[model samples]
Target: MIDHRRPVGPRTLAARAKAAVTLSASLRAAVSAGEVRRVVCLAPDPHARFAAVELGADFFVDTVLANGYGLCSYVFGWNPARQTVNAPAVDQFLGGYGDLVLRPDLATLAPLEPGVWQVVCDVEWPDGRPVPEAPRTALRERLADAEQLGLVPSVGIEQEATFTGADGAPLVPAGLDYSVAGLTPLRALLGDVHAAVDGLGLGAESARGEVHPGQYEIVLRHRDAVAACDDAMLLQAAVRRAAAARGVRAGYLAAEASGMGSSCHVHLSLSDPEGVPLTAGATPGEPSALFGHFIAGILRAAPDLTGIWAPTWNSYVRLRTAPFSPRSLRWGRDDRTAAVRLAGSGRSLRLEARFAGADAHPHLVVAALVGAGIAGVRERLPLPDEARVVGELARTPWEALTLLDSKPARAVLGDPVIDHQLAMLGEELTAGLDTVTAWQRARGDLRA
Candidate 1:
């Protein structure tokens, strides 16, 4: 496998400058042609979304400067809430007073409105080094590790979300599921969403009505790990923008009191440098050693990785045994109830991870998967018996936090990443603990 002679590392800053020059020319031409007026620069944060807008002319100049050098410190200062700056994060950002260079090839620049275009950028330190806490950087590091083992990963993501009307209620009443009548009401909206996603060069494989009322699932084709995660993020943005244009809202919360849960399922496969699938064995329906090792790694790390995959407080509510969400750490052939489902055979074999919620960060999720799988390979871990079914995964946020704080998680995901995530999520958990909910009020007010 691994071609030891091949080079590692991303495009240099010089190369990015050249690409930015070419892009600037195109942007100027589009502006002069009256095809664009405004440019939106976007960077996805842990929980909140960050964006900066500028006139087309101003954006062209800034783009060139950013690519040639870097963008300012405000980009990485804020926490997930966008309210306060995490002091440690600020220290990492050159003491909250420096710039961050954009990664050379990790950006999606496309038209979002008639006279405006949006650019999704992945970033690094000004010196062209990976930012330890950055999700994209985490995934990139894991991918590099896979490359060392001669393994290339392809990831396919399936995202399910619900639509709500202007009143913040389900767009349609309950009980439609996958019926034609259920889908007919939202056909126009779905068409626009698909069109917008396709226009941005994000491959949207298919979209369909889901089992829940006002819920829908969109499947994206497989791509190299980083690209797939990027596409997934963009897809979510596209859906929300498209829905807003139609006077509705698109929500990806894991669980809603009256509606079913939404999820983000990841399908992964390993291939060689030449693109030959490595998951299948000589015998039909059997798995190769590489596949077994990868699966073993995922199973071993599933508990520790749960917090990242199901980050929100509502995420645990979606992990019950009913309605197809997995409750156990088990693998099964064509079994939707299992955490890991084996689909296809031979060249088409892949593992589908059913644990992630739609609310999880795409980059973090991919990083965890790739990191764990690589760990499995490096350790030469053995696969568990196919017939064995493990008990339920962490069913609550506290359980997930305990697992995440363990040594195994730190070993799998470097200490920097684990520490940063724990700090961020720990804040959310603390805030939640201080609040009293309506459910508590209803159940304990008079009795207590």
Candidate 2:
């Protein structure tokens, strides 16, 4: 529920009329039908404010910084400002201020892919430049690659997270109860989430108690790749809001315990340009070499991109002994232990990446995966005869961060976003170090 007290309306009716004329009939109907609205717009970042104004959105909420990480692109109210001028079949994008997208205009909406805002940076991009390295850009590039190969990625994300006790109790208690019956509190909290998903038309399949106490998982049906990613982010926001209403903390990291780990398993399939199932093995020779390259590319890039998949200090906790936490970069036929696992053979064949953690930004993760895969396919990269599954995991968060901080990986991800991510990680580590430890007090080791 956004507060629409103030909106970013154009200065004059003529201006509004001019903008409306650019929209296609379907888009026009959507706006007239109340599908799109002039809502409150806020801009904390001056640069973003300038861009929003140029984009012609009528609301701006000021934030403390120039950019709200990804928020600038998340609140523009569905559809690329440019695309609305012509396309009728595509709806307006919709989502929170953080995960907005261009949505389709339809009377009936699906639970998983609801009509929402398509949040995009107002910054212009050249036709030839690689989609700006942001999550959306990356996904677009990857999606394009899939198209070139006559494949479309239809995906669903199964997400697991936790809601804590009202008193700020640790996210996971000592007990190890995983049964649905034992998770009464979780159910009570998620009831609103169920309603919200339904109301928003997000085709959410089910939300259930996980194998861990206090942990829960929501499964959503497969949809377009971008929609699937948007749904994942929206689902998290829904859960967070619902939990807050219930006075519970929603923790997305892995288990607080030293041993147990959490998972963000992505299930994906590919289709042909005409929307026919390409996974049916009816395609041409060499069994879609592009698919093989995509898998290989993801495996190749896994080492550098791991940070994006598991992007928090706490996420490293799930690196080992956790179900679906791959010990190595091997691809297998339905094998959970491999980093990249193949499910269903030929055409109906798809890849599932279990390496991602719940803490990751869904768009970023999928885009990065797609980029790596596209890079592999475009280059015709060779794959090993077998999936290179291994048994070791990053020793600690520090170790993983160190690996990510190295020159090789840094070169691959380039500047700005990579640097930004590293800075965030450093901030987290500093905060962790600054905290006083009970052990220090117990040992009388507090020194001035």
Candidate 3:
């Protein structure tokens, strides 16, 4: 349901100048050629403002306005090679202040780079990392790994995200009929999403309503992993922007509220130099050894991969057997209850990982999946029995993650990468807990 009413047409050089003239004349000239109205600046974090200022961004708003109008875009960045860290021991300092400390000082803001830049509307994450480890980066790394194996991995991303009401509330309790106009806000966002996807060359597939109310899904055609992930991120951002324009918020938080959940589904494939599907074996309908190895690797590493799929505590709530949710790590032929399912057994035999929630970092999830596959092939690890019953699968995400964090899993995943991912996830879990304002503190028990 892409919103048909976008910012009308593209903004003219003069209109863009009018928007920029208040802040800086130079920025007005830099974007004189009818650029899209996607980027915006914010105050409070003057550091963010200063970096944007340096990057020639002229439009400025506060964090509140940015969140409300969804205008925040782009993060001022500092490359590790080019910029010096402001704090030598920033990690240690942050670790002491919160349950899981983030590396804020690791972010160095200097100037914008030349590569394709999206209007991320404030490039910093909640913890202030300049270059965040997003799904985009994770997919890029996995593609690199695939190249080393003489295989190039390409993928298409189909994301399911929810939307909030005008008053910022869940619309699920009302009813879920994908065709309802109540979802006009989310629908409106899809138009901008389409524009974003087309610009990025990710090959837009389709945008439509889902079974759940206020829940929408966008599917894009397969391309290079990095390009696909980049398009996905922009789609996510654009959805938020479009929803904002309609006085609604596009929710990406796997579980945005109590029960509504979002998902990130990936369609992956590996090809040879000639662009023929390498995983597509000798017989058209028969599964290739590569496909088996990859699927087996993912299954073997499911427990450890929990951190990539269910990154947040709340995300686990959506994993148990319920409406459109998976509860176990079993793989089956088109079984939605299993964490991984083999859809096509032929040359197109590919496993769909159902565990990843919208909140899961795309980069980490893809990397873990691909890495596990490579490990399986390299080590000749035996594939486990296909899961026949959901009851046999782990009940909680932690159960799987704990298994993944075991000595054997760590050995296969490499200690350093596992440690870093776990540490980062631990930090996110800590941050999720710090939202104390959502609850009530009763000083005394109510004895009526």
Q: Candidate 3 lDDT, tens digit per residue, 306-391?
A: 66677666677666533566655566767666667666655465667776778766655666777777776666665556774323
Tally clashing residue pairs in candidate 1: 1
TM-score result, candidate 3: 0.66
Off by over 4 Å in 2: 1-133, 145-151, 169-178, 279-288, 345-347, 385-387, 390-394, 402-416, 437-448
Selected candidate, larger lDDT, 2 vs 3: 2
Per-residue C-alpha lDDT of model 2 across residues 1-448, encoded as one tens digit per residue: 2211111110122222243233323333443555543321222111011122212121211221123222333322222122121112111222222332222111111222233432323221222233233454445555666566665677778778766776646455643334655665455566776776555456667766676657777777776665576556656666776777767777777554556566778876655655565433344322256577777777777776666776666677677656557657777767776777777665456778888877666766776676667677777887655655532335566665666666644444545445544544555566568778766687786563
TM-score per model over all chains: 0.86, 0.68, 0.66
Output the lDDT of residue 218, model 1. Answer: 83
Put the candidates in TM-score order, highest first.
Answer: 1, 2, 3
Q: What is the per-residue lDDT of model 1 for residues 1-448, given as tens digits with 9 covering 90 to 100?
A: 1110101112223333355556656766676776777766665666624445344545554564346335665555555555545446345654646777654342345566677776656667766776767776777777777888888888888888889887777777674555787777788998888888776665567777877778888877777676677668777888898999999899988876433678888888888766778899887577788888998898889888888888878788787533678767888888887889988887778899888888888888888988898889888899888857754568888888888888888877788888777766666687678789988898897796
**lDDT measured at residue 356 in model 1 versus the true structure, 0 to 100:** 88
The predictions' CA RMSDs to the true structure, in order, are 5.4, 11.1, 10.9
